[model samples]
Target: MTVTQVALIKMPAGNEYFNLLTKAGIVFDYIALMWLLALTNGVLSPLFPIAYLVVMHATIYWRTKGAILSSISLTAGYSTIFAVQAQFDFNTTFVFILNLVFIWIIGVFGSLIVIRERKHLKQKEIFHELMFTDYLTGLYNHRHFQEQLRIMTRARQNFLLVMGDIDHFKQINDQFGHLIGDEILKNLGGIFRDLAEDYDAQAFRYGGEEFAFLLPSIEETRQISFFDDLYGRLSSEKFSKECLSVTMSFGIASSKSGILPDKLLGYADQLLYSAKANGKNQVKFESRYTYYYSKAKEEIAASKQ
Candidate 1:
């Protein structure tokens, strides 16, 4: 199966169905354990209730609060059985209360373990977000872009890699100061996010004043209008408190078979330079012939060696 199909299959079911199934399984398992203990109690020692406490530990997977609730219910059910066995004897009644205390201790320990597990999971999520997200603009960082490129390359999927750099960014930073430059970057990040969403594309903040876009399965004819719309939106967008107009140069390269991610990005970067050289605030695209030419060059070099 394809990676996309596998991903869809592995995705979690709805929360409501999961919760119901889990709770029912927990309840049924506990009930079965209780019945087995009762049936075997006569042949076993009276101290067998301790086995019930050990069984309660399984509830730990339900998390801290859920485990505590399960523990309470278990205590109530086990205590009822113990009280019946005590038969009004002082010594037996004392032992029953002692066993109950031990059960609560087990419950408390299980809850503590669950709490720690929860905290660890939360930390992992936070670390993952920090790793993949840009601090300045909250966009997907370059590291994530590398990962996306790797996945797409492995799958042999075709996509357009569009690189954009703000026009005259250094001048803007020099004239308006770094803080205003930062604000402009933040605003551009938002603009890219909106445009990417509208166009069904993935966007990233490549670094500094640079950004990247991945447009999957976009047709050659459609790409022109898409870039035109993107150019229009960016040109019309205001920046700084001065409401100054801002523009960006874009370079786009489409994936071809046998092309590596780094090479594609480099080609796009070259196109970006071309856009800036010709005049800023324009879009430069790769010719399909370029890939064949590069491939032919590689073949020629390999044959000569």
Candidate 2:
């Protein structure tokens, strides 16, 4: 019974029908156990209170409806057992009525406590979400980005940090107005949101016309492919005006062992400027150590040949 209760508790909370079926099964088991005890010990078994306690505890997870159902079933079971085994006298009738009342009281109070707890938990979740989420993009905010970056650095996990900027964004705003610029930002945000979901990455709005992505380390070829895909997606977007065309430039820096978050961010920022200087609507990536190591290997191979 303890194992069964634990299993029920571990099950997903979203499946209403499954939870209902499992709760019904537990009630049936309790009823069967009660009947067995009544038949063997003349309906006045000392162990019956323990069974009632189990029923009440289980009803906590089921809420008010479950509590009411358990109370009715247990009361009916006890009354039937007493009718069959004991004579209907004043004392017996009084005890039976008291037991029914006790069961109902336990059910009502247990369910009420659970309801209160669930409401409190929901409120906390909503508060935390608002604290970490960006209002405009619906992505994580800058504060969360800093927190996650620090966590990754502390753990020494290898990753790639990308910094992106919308090309000629100030000019676009001057030409089209801030309202149109806002719509453009929203469109870019939607694209970033979708990409992050598809690639298991984190995207953040690093203030106006700037965004960031934290992606798990992958092969250079795959990283190039990822950049190409993002560029294509941005180029293909259509805004309210047919004449508007949007493009973004991005720079990625690979994490190194024991690298500080600030230095890593600076490196990516430098590369972003490099992309803009060379030409806009492009991506640049840097990994100094990896480049040197590969060069050394090629030199060694040539020397051996």
Q: Give the best candidate by TM-score.
A: 2
Candidate 2: Cα lDDT at 167: 88
After superposing candidate 2 on the true structure, give the runs of residues whose Cα lies further than 4 Å from its correct spot.
Answer: 1-99, 171-187, 235-245, 287-305
lDDT of 2 by residue, 229-300 (tens): 676676678855833678778889989999999999999999888888877777777853122221433544
CA lDDT of 280 in candidate 2? 70
Instruction: Give the clashing residue pairs of candidate 1, or none.
Output: none
Each candidate's lDDT (Cα)? 0.72, 0.77
- Total clashing residue pairs per candidate? 0, 0
Q: Poorest 10 consecutive residues of model 1 by lDDT? A: 288-297
Q: What are the models' TM-scores?
A: 0.62, 0.69
Relative to the unseen true structure, what is the C-alpha lDDT of residue 162 in candidate 1, on a scale of 0 to 100?
Answer: 91
At residue 66, give the lDDT of candidate 2: 70
> Which stretches of candidate 1 lie above 4 Å from their native place?
1-107, 232-236, 287-305
What's the residue-level lDDT of 300 in candidate 2? 43
